[model samples]
Target: MLSYARQTLKRVPSFQELLQGTMGSAKEEISVDVLVIGAGPTGLGAAKRLNQIDGPSWLIVDSNETPGGLASTDVTPEGFLYDVGGHVIFSHYKYFDDCIDEALPNEDDWYTHQRISYVRCKELWVPYPFQNNISMLPKEDQSRCVDSMIDAFVEARISATKPKDFDEWIVRNMGVGVADLFMRPYNYKVWAVPTTKWEQMQCAWLGERVAAPDVKKVITNVIHNKTAGGWGPNATFRFPARDGTGGIWIAVAKTLPKSNTRFGEHGAVTKIDADAHRATLKDGTVVKYQKMVNTMAVDSLVQHMGDKELVDLSKGLFYSSTHVIGVGIRGERPERIGDKCWLYFPEDNCPFYRATIFSNYSPYNQPQKDVKLPTQQLANGSKPSSSEAKEGPYWSIMVEVSESSMKPVDGKSLLADCIQGLVNTDMIKPTDEIVSTYHRRFDHGYPTPTLEREGVLKQLLPALQAKDIWSRGRFGSWRYEVGNQDHSFMLGVEAADNIVNGAVELTLNYPDFVNGRQNTERRLVEGAQVFAKSKKSVD
Candidate 1:
């Protein structure tokens, strides 16, 4: 009986194909054990796990044909590739590491890089974790940061209270010098929220994430005119040897059952009837499922469901959009720009908060060293006389800008502004020939850890779960700390486990707990000997 049901279900037209059927042939319902929405890493993660278990009739659908979500990559007309931002592979989980390894198995499949990072201040490149490297700052700036650090240290030793806002937290830990110079301005640019509006709880993630300077060491280094070495967890990471970050997801998607996945315009979900366990696709087919995993932004999901209560609660969650801009140039890689992965921009010289030397990740990131293309214009907006399609080599850079109502951008001129900013920051030569460009706006980019965010998610998630719908993912849960690819993927994995078996999802509920330790035990198949078997089967 079960086998017959499974076979019949497979033959039934999908919600999408129903549109092509005759008027009377259009089905009123279709059924599956589980329906996963959004083909991003998180949704794919859920689908991947479901496939591994080989349990329950499951199907995954996404609006876009491609995968990767924000971690995806884009290519320029000139053949340059740029990721959404700077997506480096640095995982805290063996499971995630193993999964990526499985996707791109060969040594040539990856590029291991030592992070060459920097901060721009007063036209000088300072080592990151600006608070810890105050010795490199100008004498006056150093004095200010050092004095503030001492005061903060003394105050913390005696004071019985904790800081309340992000600004106070910065001053308490980094001192006024670092705060005034780097912390305050830089964070505002990146977060699109004033430090005053940010809560101190957000600082909990910054310890290992940000490098703190030792005053004595910094002073000594400054006196000796010495620069600090690389700091932070991602001082080294892996990148795909080919394609951009998106290649990893695309490859991972290939490992899944093709029949279980749906994409393109037909995949767009118009409405979801939670009570009926039904989802209406763009083509007017209804899909009924026993369980649903939604990866769309929670706020958007609420709107799609037309649930008044969920929508109201979701309003408490807030996020800022991201603008990714890529530029490919005609020339050899610059000498001054040697081996830098990404750089931070805090000053007003540029609207972008960060810039990655996209070409530095791989040679294929740009057009073949020999591909010829006419120059659109120089970096400075000047038309070049060189109609010559001459290029033996090329390099590219990608930049990210945060936009919100609070921090509005001139969209019409944002690309031009970013190019000018690149020149101002010496990232590009004014007369450098520009070969290609790419720009895209993602509406629900970064979920802000606003003071109100936690309160809302606390209520919203449980409410959805009570209705048998699991809203999980980057914007789905709206927790920035757990919103990375690994975290988001695990959220789905754990969510599925919780629904299938009564398992406690440590990563989803307690991010700090999962993040605090090296999670080595979360693999689908364990043991070194089993790796070969697992690899062969997964491949």
Candidate 2:
């Protein structure tokens, strides 16, 4: 054996090289008419619209190797798939639907399922939109909920101050009984905000979020012991048949020209020279654009821009972090969880606010029947008697737990706590063998519509626009009222249109108008017609 080793020295560039433009193949001063940051739904929407217009030089960049921000999916080493949380496709805009269909056109690309959601409370499963389904609750709960709703409804006719806060909104509409039983604890778990803080939370952010029960209809349903079937916009929704939700974005990205997109480490925005209308990438390449459509979190964009005044103003905005935990079990789907798409946990039994029957959404969500895997541990953390690998059918559950400075979580024990939560909530048995697990935390998960939200956005959005920056997306725009996938996508599409032809960004500025009706201003099929006409004109 030779005692000599070959020495290979690889030069790593310093931070100064990256800052001063000494790395990579990107040009020093590349310019575009429109520059989009982040390749998530919002960014893709902007790019799709820009490509459709065929009038501007545009480029879309993202730090992620693949698209989809919070909407992305992750697969464990054992082949179990999980999304960021529980994401269901329920479109409010025809343009949004057209864009999704254009991406995954085939009938086989999706799996449609009726919404079968429930709220777990007092060890009973109540139909979702809890207020409307109070009939399913225990006798005492039903009486309390109904009485309070009637009182609140009558008070609404005489009262004049709208609502002071979310707490007051719930009490004024849902009544005190429902608030104490479900709304209070459930929302606390989801938003990581205390019930008392609801008084400090604005009510406008709740547009279309909650459905107040019709007192007469609710009384009729309760009298008959009948269950409410379809209630929310997501009553009937679809999931991608493959690659999880990330598959949808990947398919969408495939439609855009690759030359106009940049991703991975090289595409991350390190700094933005708003004064110079330039953005610096992680690789030291600077992108100069006439107008930038920033899809990153507004706070994150502010941090990268290094703007002191904007940073201070952004302090008024508050957001909660999300912890997504996934558990893949090595067995067939259990009878208790049969066909239940998603379940809400309002009791103290579970650390998670919500749990989705992920495997039931699609067969591709779990591994094949033949894949072999050893049980890592039981849901309760007991050691497996046998260390050998086993195989056959499998099932999975995805859970979402919120965290913030107000609500701190022990990260080291989160997975274990989640497993225990599953057992406590009857989602999994103590002896259930867990094959795979996943835990991911997103910093800017839910943009809280705090009392100061309106005040901040009033000044913040216009300030960014003065610098030719359109900061729009879930976190970018900071509007939880219109923060769904469809709404986020349209925010980008509308932002692009606004930049190009002075079009109104209805989705951004007037969320109530967009959420309340079907927006059909543009169609994907019409886009093809326009494209053909434009090509003919050019020829």
Candidate 3:
């Protein structure tokens, strides 16, 4: 690569002439057909598809030492694993499944989970699809909810026009009582923005992701004192049996040739010179490419390029930072927890919006029962009576706290607050020994689907694409509805298709179209016409 750079420099001596009076060492340069930034699932997907086609010379890179970007997991000193937030494998595409299956082919590599989940409401656990399970609420609350739901049904029968914003949609579909009691507070806690205020979120991003209550069925359930069945894409999901969520991407990255990937300090991209189609890494290696697939947050990418117009447009995009807090308890798994996978907290009683039993996902997620560990502190913040290490069958819980301008958190006290909240909600006993605690803050967490997002993306994306850059991923596309692991991965796949063969970027442009049905166009098999090798016609 260094020799190539020297030869290129010799061929074009303008760089040498300009640096005649300056002290500088020649930087190594490498070339590829596609330069992929960020070795997350999205970047991996692009590289995987490119490799499958055998047409593009591509290199995937990330600043992190590991491959999983936001979807990655971290481990505590005590051996507990925590994902960035709640994450489970629920696919909307066959290609995504094929790639994941390729990565972890063994049945033992994963544990399929039946979604044992609930919402904490009025100091009671309500089966989720909280709107469908209002039967569990106190009688008075149920009465109000049913009355408003009946009103919403009547309104739905008469109303023709669509809801303008997420707030209105919530009220129109779930009724004012459901909105006020659960939807409003839960969304606020998750998005860190009010659904009805100036920062009101848009509703188009929701493509059947949120369940609309079946009014008559819900009423019947209420009358019969029953709970609704599980709903949505994640009703039954899977998790890695060994590492946490991050393990999947790491395994996927291994499928790609190591020579094609750069990670850690070497992969940290410092600048992107779009005019020259070059990306400069932190190690001073310049990677020149015919096309680029950028998986970093689009807002950050625009600022890195120093494009004033794009930066100005990117400012309209909103996001919330996530603080993931984990607590490892030194005890047997409590019966109250049962097989519960994740639980949601909507009220102010907890700083976290949701909590997952990380230990429940897999036995390896926490240390083995024989692994002894000393208590860091009690759940109630008091010193443990015994500081000596102890052995136990242990369980762990991971909680997520959202922070933004509208909903700021006390960073220093957030972990403590979350632990105390567990006790308050009976998630953990006050005297439970916390053997491990982990806290991490990710700045670009949940991308907000604000009213202004479309206008900014319409302009910003095209401007970048004109320079042969395709920014697509969770934060890259900034559409939370299509921002899961599956969606993000397919975004890269579609971007590659557009770059190589000019296929329509369905995941990027037609989110609702893609989300409305199962997309089985491209499979890792013969006769999958959508993914066949094609001539490079986009240029």
- Which digits, one per residue and each the tens of the lDDT, describe model 2 over residues 433-495? 999999999988899889999999999999999999999999989999889898889889989
Identify the runs in model 2 with alpha carbons over 4 angstroms from their true place.
Answer: 1-27, 517-539
RMSD of each: 5.5, 9.1, 5.5
Flag clash pairs in model 3.
Answer: none
Estimate every model's Cα lDDT from 0 to 1.
Answer: 0.79, 0.86, 0.85
Clashing pairs in 1: 132-212, 132-213, 369-392
User: Residue 174 deviation, candidate 2, in Å?
Assistant: 1.3
Q: Alpha carbon lDDT of residue 39, candidate 2? A: 91
Candidate 3 structure, TM-score to reference: 0.92
lDDT of 1 by residue, 397-494 (tens): 89999998778888889999999999999988899989888999888778887666667878999899877888899887787878778878877877
Q: Which ten residues in a row have the lowest lDDT in candidate 1?
A: 519-528
Query: Which residue pairs clash in candidate 2?
Result: none
User: Weakest 10 consecutive residues, lDDT, candidate 3?
Assistant: 1-10
Query: Looking at model 2, which ten-residue stretch has the lowest summed lDDT?
Result: 1-10
The number of clashing residue pairs in each candidate reads 3, 0, 0
All candidates: TM-score: 0.91, 0.91, 0.92
